[model samples]
Target: MKTYRYLDLITALFVVVLIVSNVASTKVVLLGPFTFDGGTILFPLAYIFGDVLTEVYGYKRSRRVIWTGFFLLMLAALTFGLVNLLPTPADPQSQGTAQAFSTILGLVPRIVLGSLVAYWVGEFVNSFILAKLKIATQGRWLWVRTIGSTLVGQGLDTGIFLLIAFYGVWDNSLLWTVFVSNYVFKVGVEVLFTPVTYAVVGFLKRREGEDYYDRDTDFNPFALGR
Candidate 1:
């Protein structure tokens, strides 16, 4: 029953990033030589937030935030699907914007399922591993836990999401290429942002007087009881 000044703010930011990432995933874009879904640019920041959450607050709090994200994502996908299903009014000259709405906001069932599943799994894994590493390292070497957890978490996330979202829909070689690109890029972001992560974690730990250790935490993704 502990409270932190910034936990709510952090969780809100995490949810916002996740929702935006989903919205942006509709377009495959080329950035320089790399071709990736638009989400690829914004998606990795969720992991950075994930690291910050677990690192500062511990696994149990992070688990609640992860489940919060999962529920919100599911609700978003559900709402988008229902909205897309509504009938568009008929007009002879109407360049129907309904179709455009559908194209933009409609959820692909497979991709939605993949995204929710991958996000739930990957975030929990990231939180759990970071919590464990915090204890193992005796709370030293913040970079190790952040980057190490991202390496594993983002790997699972990118691979599982791409496989489910694009395996049959995309060319085989392109699928693997995108998978590799996504994974490498996500992990790379964690490395590049390590200093930022350290600064945030340090500030939160000091301000909130909570550098929690999850030694006795349940680590259950489904159990959100507080």
Candidate 2:
């Protein structure tokens, strides 16, 4: 397998973002009128990372990183659940600590399902759209591909995740509100950070000498080709 100096770094960062975002999602936050989970603050960075990967390294590499994140996230979830289930010794401090641990690390089945499924679909969609756009535009406009892909990808992600995680649990109106707010906030993050994304993508392209255009590449998400 070929190695790039920064691919490993980016992949590691990508997984950290994914795992941390999911963990932070347990806490809901309200800033004035907008209601969102803590994940919203950092989840958008994952999409930016997606854009950077697909833009600089192409979809094949990006797909690999996405799968890496998915599996690591599942492992983290399983580990958290396992730890949450382990019997803790009966003591004043221990009991309090165990309860706090479960409160923070516990993973509900529906939420787990929503998170994994939505992430797999959303990230592939983002990478696939960006790859196709790169070819369609002859690589002229970076912003179009990044923002356009995020528009589609984040829209699907926000809607699918919220609906699956809270459809019946939350009021219909409230679910919709959360979905709309999260979607806007995520896409807004992509837009607001476009300058940074451009800088990173440009730097990587120059430094690594790889501006991949997936004209001949396979688009299958499951294929483990290099």
Candidate 3:
């Protein structure tokens, strides 16, 4: 087995971004004319990290990282669900605090399932597209690969998550609004952060001596053994 210096750090950051975004998703907020879950603010960064991982480490490693984030995210939701099931103290203050905790951290089964499924599918899509684009472009244009993948990947992520989590719960108009808003915002962030993505990719490739191309890789999301 081969190892790199920053792989662990990048994996750690990727998982952190995923878990935090899931937590933030409990609150819906409006930013200017856009209305979305608070997680929308930070969730896009996970794709950027996904781009970096696929661009530098290849899709195989990126698959491992994605699965790592997925499992950890599932564990977090389970943990919160467990805590929410525990009995609260009978004292008034304790009851209030407990209520707040449940309100904030209690994981809804539908939302949790939606989030996990969306992330798993969307990230794999993002990584697969970026990896293929990298090969197609011969690594010439980083911006195209990053933005292009985000366009499709984020679309799927937003649509899948929204439909699964809130299709019946939220007003149809509001759901459409958030869907459009999230897709645009996420893709916009990818475009705006192109320079940063290039810098990070360049640095990681240089430092780690790897600029992997998935030319002959399995491209399997569950093929973690290799």
Candidate 4:
């Protein structure tokens, strides 16, 4: 019912970053023998922001933001599909470029599906846990809620996304490796950023004059009406 001037804008930006990072995440480059997917670097921030949204704004508001992101991703996937389906120019060079675009964009469906599912589950878990912890601790120990929620939320997110996106494509061992690596990387990012999270949460609470408890809020992920 209520809207903040910058909430929608922030949600839009988060969604755009999520989509771009997912697309760019295909490559795992070595940083002096320490290898990591490029996406792993930026992807955890989305969760951090997600936690902030839910912790400060409540589940209803966070739900709207998450659904907005899901729809935006679907729109992006549809556009990619349409572009790939359209006929390329007669020039061989143009055709090659078109094919390359298709190769990159064609993976959108699986990636988007996995993303939507993982995001929905993981974010809700983070928020639900944070809200409960906030009440239980009477809003004390902010770091505990943030890091504790992330440990659970990021674990589910990494596992679900990898399993849904790459389960059968890679060998079992490789799949497990990716699962472990991504999970550790994401959770590590959350732990490292805990200080930043505390600062942001403090600032938002002070500025917004709101520290939502979600005492009477619904936790249903499918109830978009909230």
Q: Which one wins on lDDT? A: 3
Task: Return the TM-score for candidate 2, rounded to 2 decimals.
Answer: 0.98
Q: At residue 82, give the lDDT of candidate 1.
A: 95
Tens digits of lDDT, candidate 3, 123-190? 99999999999999999999999999998899999999999999999999999999998888888889
Could you tell me which 10 consecutive residues in candidate 3 have the lowest summed lDDT?
217-226
Quantify all predictions' global Cα lDDT against the true fold: 0.88, 0.91, 0.93, 0.79
Candidate 3: Cα lDDT at 126: 93
TM-score of 4: 0.91
Q: Tens digit of lDDT per residue, candidate 1, span 1-226?
A: 8878999999999999999999998988887767778898999999999999988888888888888899999999999999898776787433377778788888789999889989988999999999999999999998989888998999899888988888889999999888887887778888998888888988999999988888888887777784
Show model 2 residue runs off by greater than 4 Å.
Answer: none
Best by TM-score: 3
**Comparing 3 and 4 on lDDT, the stronger one:** 3
Name model 3 segments beyond 4 Å from true.
none
User: Backbone clash tally for model 1?
Assistant: 0
Best of the two (2, 4) by lDDT: 2
Residues 1-226, model 4: lDDT tens digits: 6656556666877797778867777676544433455678788888888878877887778877877877886777778878888898899999899988987776656766787788778877887888788888888888888888998998898788877877787788876767677777788888899899888877887777778887888878778785
